[model samples]
Target: MKTPLSPKSTSGLRGEYAGAGDDFTVEQDWQSYSPEAHDRWRRLYAAQSALAARYAAPQFLEGLAKLDSAGGIPRFDDANRVLQAETRWTLVAVPGFIPDAVFFDHLAHRRFPVTRWLREEHELDYLVEPDVFHDFFGHVPMLLDPRIADFLEMYGRAGEKAMAMGALDMLARIYWYTIEFGLVREEGGLKVFGAGIVSSAGETVYAIEDEAVLRLPFDPERVMRTAYSIDNFQQNYFVLDSLDQLIGSLVGLDFGPIYERWRHEQPLPAGQLQAGETPFKAVRLESLGERTP
Candidate 1:
């Protein structure tokens, strides 16, 4: 991968808060996409779907089926038809990741900004920043759930609040661990809800089956206090009992205090156990012990 980290810009869209100097808008060239571009989407879709089917959360899989997303690159208009009816969420086009505020603002309004660009064929397995496939296929399907839909809006506002308090680093941890790399326990077994897992074949299984990754109970404060890495496979996967459990706890939190405490605290390394003493086998056995009957 020559460039795993791709610079994403928000395409200019009139927003109530958009300022003159903001460089957030991403330019789109929808008509310029070639046959190879669409094929890449198909190839990734076929590959990731097979791997994720066993590892991904049932909700994510069900929503994906509801969206009828097996086809190649999803057209925003067609995707909106199903998404709007399912959760009233719409996918809008952006060049890439928009500015923090703009990104949050769009989510607050239930408008998800999907990059108009797809990853190159060689870059299918990974892309540093979110691309169209990451945005639409990975994240969009989950919006079909009513609870998750509301949670994302709240997540956006929480992000804005974190920015205002200069605590976005803390807030990003919450986003990274949950929205990007979260796992959930289902009747059958551990399943993936995180977009990062859904989009990557390697992570889809590693996040759930890898004994090296710590599977912690979902606590908003713990998540906010925890630090995460963006450049590699996650060393920890926060496990949620359910989406309701994850979102319900965050509705009333005021993170200013949380961030303040985090400032003085040392961040836990990716695979660090609670007390930082355990081999992967011990950690796995401990996890099995914590589950409910």
Candidate 2:
């Protein structure tokens, strides 16, 4: 859900404006996708899938297997059949980014908004905005996990509270650090579960193997108080012991007091560690030894 706090003007962005309804949803028009678009998806999937197998969490790998999206850009209707059965979630198509309120409402009800259009050929390596590949290939598999599924619904429900309290920035940080760019400690070593990392081959390896990055244990208050960068690879990534820990940290927890204290305070810089904070030890990639290709 890479949405803006307020709706940006999309007057000239015909890709995002055409056929959108009051709610900003549009028909996926699955058949209209060119063969080239499907080919692009195939290439993106093949490259990322190999990287993911070596560095992704078991839960993510399981979900990816269930998705069976290797062949082409999946029809949302077809993917929904598996998603609805697995987690009672559905994917809705939108032209591009929508307003935060609209985004929260969709998540609150277990509907995910995926962009209807694909990026052009030249933009394959990188794109500033989220496109269909980033939304579906990056995120949808994780939605198959029950913990993640329930956690997101709760996050969506909490949106109004964050907005009313003028704490949307803090909440967005939570989403950015966890859903979009989180890491987790599995039995083998540190592995990525974040969509943002798993979707990019470069980061999929960089996040774990790069000793220069800062990895810290997940802390709700610390996460909310931290700032992040969008233009490049993250300087800091939060690590979860388990998905259960992630859910337990926020379930029925009050954020009012936390927000009141930090809302007026300057956010901690992205890469700088606070005094007394310890960084998680980097995982040794060489020790992993011969992963399946």
For candidate 2, what is the lDDT?
0.87
| Alpha-carbon runs more than 4 Å astray in model 1 | 1-29, 264-266, 276-293
Spell out the clash pairs found in candidate 1: 10-24, 10-25, 10-26, 11-25, 11-26, 12-25
* lDDT of residue 245 for candidate 1: 88
Q: How would you encode candidate 2's per-residue C-alpha lDDT over 141-242 as one tens digit per residue?
A: 999999999988988988999989999899988889988899988886899999889888788888898888999999999999998888798999999999
Which residue pairs clash in candidate 2?
none
Q: What's each prediction's TM-score?
A: 0.84, 0.96
Instruction: Kindly report which residue stretches of model 2 are placed more than 4 angstroms away from their true locations once superposed.
Output: 4-8, 11-14, 291-293
Cα-based lDDT for every prediction: 0.72, 0.87
Q: Which candidate should be chosen as best, given lDDT against the real structure?
A: 2
As a whole number from 0 to 100, the lDDT of residue 84 in candidate 2 is 97
User: What does candidate 1's lDDT look like per residue over 86-193, in tens digits?
Assistant: 888987776555567777877888887776777776786677867778877888888898988888888777766777777776777877887788887777357788
